[model samples]
Target: MSFCSFFGGEVYKDHFKPGVYVCSKCDHQLFTSRSKYEHSSPWPAFTETIREDSVSKHQERPGAFKVQCGKCGNGLGHEFVNDGPARGSSRF
Candidate 1:
């Protein structure tokens, strides 16, 4: 999933309807449509997750974090801090 997202995969890049995005391997709710937004990147970008614990974050390095499914630990993508619409918010 991370590879596909990094390589500009076309899974949910254009999906803007009100719905929930789940993990392919576990069906755990990860993101919601309300948080979805259009971005210049080819992957689907969200301003937030479905819940505070919906995704887990791991510090890959200084100022970099990797995001994964909280329920199944599937590699979803990366999270960028202070780079989203809201102040101090994260982009997933």
Candidate 2:
């Protein structure tokens, strides 16, 4: 299946309703749509995760982080510190 089939329409342009979002391949619950927010970026954004271990984070470099599905290792997106809706905050 394509990435958008599980994630939604286009990344940032798609507005997901409040619900639970899971991995398309494994059905592992990854995020809740309620946490989804609009940041004017080119992908869907979330304020937080449904659980502490629902997702995984990888540090690509000294200060860069890549967020992905914990169960299937699907590339969800990235996390940026102090670059969200609020200053000095983080979003995925």
Candidate 3:
């Protein structure tokens, strides 16, 4: 069974929801809709995107964190700040 992710509107209904958003390219479960504090960011505003093992951080754009699929190494998206709750929680 093949499964798509939230990227490009290709997500499987059975696994799509607010819990742990996994990557289609990678079977890594990250982020959730609930973690999204409903703010406006250039990209998807996620309070957190899974634990440390689910993501890979690479240097890009001089000094930036690049999010890549842990399984297939697909470029899912980039993460940003200045939004969500001010609780200063770990985004892992």
Candidate 4:
């Protein structure tokens, strides 16, 4: 999906089940319901991952980073600094 469409909060707006979210390409577990919480952002936000190695981060540019599946290198989302629950950060 395009970045705007993916982040437009339309994909998982109704997904409230407590389960692990995985990469669609490789089934690599990325985030879990426990770390999820509501935010004003268009996309779903997670405070943490299932594990430290669950996803990989790449510097897209200065002060910007992109998140990808650690196992298959698929783009998952972007990371941003904010007053989120996870030590003042959040991932989308």
Candidate 5:
């Protein structure tokens, strides 16, 4: 399945609760989320992700972010601005 089926939102760039964005492409799960003051990047952006082989970046005209899922390949948006100056991370 694709992310659009699970978390399909016209504009996922919107701020959301804190959590991790599982890879609909790889079923890779980890810690991440959209903080209250996170950057709203158009692509799926996770302030934090699995430090190991859990996530992997793909190739594109610009580029697309994909999560490593155990089941299948999942698209977890792209990496945007993290509240490093603040706290928590945002997934868009």
Candidate 6:
């Protein structure tokens, strides 16, 4: 599968330069390049957020959380614990 299907962006197996990333649906700044990191998974990963309220998390299923755009409530991805390159939890 293409990585774009996961994050709505062409997946490059490299870190993105420091910049702003917005929600595809609402154009709200949901993540910053500084927070992004390369993961072995299909989609990119983020270790942190630019702001505390940049995104919203919802429990999609048991033991899994669905991340969404805070402004427009567009589904972004899922949150996984201990699934990052540095052993940090990440948003996939």
lDDT (tens digit, per residue) of candidate 6 on 1-92? 11233534554446466677777666777667777786677666777656767778878776567887778788777877566557556555
Clashing pairs in 6: none
For every model in order, what is the number of clashing pairs?
A: 0, 1, 1, 0, 24, 0
User: How accurate locally is residue 44 in candidate 6, as Cα lDDT from 0 to 100?
Assistant: 64
What's the TM for model 6? 0.74
TM-score winner: 1
Residues 23-69 of candidate 2 have per-residue lDDT tens digits of 66677787677777776776667777778787799888654589887
Measured with C-alpha atoms, the lDDT of residue 50 in candidate 2 is: 77
lDDT of 6 at 70: 76
Off by over 4 Å in 3: 1-17, 81-92
- Assess every candidate by TM-score: 0.84, 0.75, 0.58, 0.76, 0.41, 0.74
Give the per-residue lDDT of model 1 (tens digit) for 28-74: 88888888888777778888888888989999976568999899888
The lDDT of model 4 is: 0.72
Better of 2 and 4 by TM-score: 4
- Of candidate 1, the 10-residue stretch with the lowest lDDT total is 1-10
| TM-score of candidate 1 on Cα atoms, chains taken together | 0.84
- Cα misplacement distance, residue 39 of candidate 4 (Å): 1.6
Writing each residue's lDDT as its tens digit, candidate 5 over 1-92 gives 12322444544345365555555555456445532233443443344544555555554333334444434545444443343334444343
Root-mean-square deviation of candidate 3:
5.0
CA displacement after TM-score superposition, residue 81 of candidate 1 (Å): 0.3
Ranking by TM-score: 1, 4, 2, 6, 3, 5
Candidate 2 residue runs with Cα over 4 Å from true position: 1-12
The TM-score that candidate 3 achieves is 0.58
What tens digits encode model 3's per-residue C-alpha lDDT throughout 2-79? 333345663333343555566665566766656655343334456566566666767556434677766777675554
Over the full model, what C-alpha lDDT does candidate 2 score relative to the true structure? 0.69
**lDDT, each prediction:** 0.78, 0.69, 0.53, 0.72, 0.43, 0.66
Model 2, C-alpha of 86: deviation from truth (Å): 2.8
